[model samples]
Target: MAMTQTQRFGIFAALALVMAATRIHHSTLHHFDALPDASWGVFFLAGFWLRGAARWAFPLLMAEAVLIDYVVITHLGIDFWSHYCVSAGYWFLIPSYGALWLGGSWLAKHQVGLRLSTLALAVVALLVSESLCYLISNGSFYWISANVPAPRSFAAWFENLGDWYLPFLQTTALYVGLGAVLHVLAVQVARLAQHRGQTQH
Candidate 1:
């Protein structure tokens, strides 16, 4: 049984709201919460359930992320460039997230075992997604201030990389762990819905 376009939209919209709300509290408190954020799940499910519609859904997801972060930055009085840094990071990471989601969604079809697979996907996502964030913000830092770090010594470069990458790695790990759980749940719900639909017919 195939999911209808309306069904896909409803699923994606609901997931987006979940993503937004869950992140809001954590971001406001400057705390990285362990709740599952649905942004990547939305993008993944949107692609799996909606196909071509995912093109629009992915960008809209990114836009929503930027808007939410912007509001938080304003409320927190963080530098505006920080907002830009995050937005750019999300922009860079979206494709990696999308690909991860797509891969997981594909695995779902085969009833591929969940726990180990989910962890693997989450790890892959954490690595690439966080790395992208580090790269984007590192570039931004360099652009804003030259001589930020010299590659003259291995320790110097390592410290510079750590300054940019460590926080992102922690955040991504937390976010992706929750996301993996949510992805598993979403697939289950969709399966139940499909089963029910078949019964109704």
Candidate 2:
């Protein structure tokens, strides 16, 4: 039988919870080190599975991020609400994700795609998302903190962009690759489970 939306949602929700728990545990044990970009699997699945509702996908992902950020920030003595508000800018990453997925889908449908091409696209998409995130974060910090230096003009914005751009690119690419591998493994596991269930029946 085909899965119902509610069933699918429940499955995704459970997966998200598991991912979140694992992230917290690992972060704690290893001094807040990111285990993997498991959350990107959530984004990729949203694109491939629920492409039509991509906007909603971002909000949901951001909500999870907000929850996680809140815990981390509070533990570090930062104000929860302010951090949540700042983190809201992460929603911008969705458009970058959509662009990548859509481009890849289009290429695949045309049967003119290479595995490396899609992987490169994923990396570029992550970089774009990270750049956008840097802008969002810098702006938020400027807005919230009076002591923070203002990017008052185009040059300042450019400078700010340069400052975080490389780090963002590196980390985003790393996470995107990690996320892609996780997504592939997940698809394999799901297919295997389905096959086993069919055999049992």
TM-score of each: 0.55, 0.54
**lDDT per residue (tens digit) for residues 77-150 in model 1:** 88755553443333445555566456444534543445676456545644554465455545544444333535
- Angstrom error at residue 56, model 2: 4.8
lDDT per prediction? 0.57, 0.52
Question: What are the per-model C-alpha RMSD values against the true structure?
Answer: 5.5, 6.1
Question: C-alpha displacement of 17 in model 2, angstroms?
Answer: 4.6
Residue 131's lDDT in candidate 1: 62
Superposition error at 156 for model 2 (Å)? 3.7
List candidate 2 stretches off by more than 4 Å: 1-50, 53-56, 75-78, 81-114, 143-147, 150-153, 184-201
Whole-model alpha-carbon lDDT for candidate 2: 0.52
Q: What is candidate 1's local distance difference test score?
A: 0.57
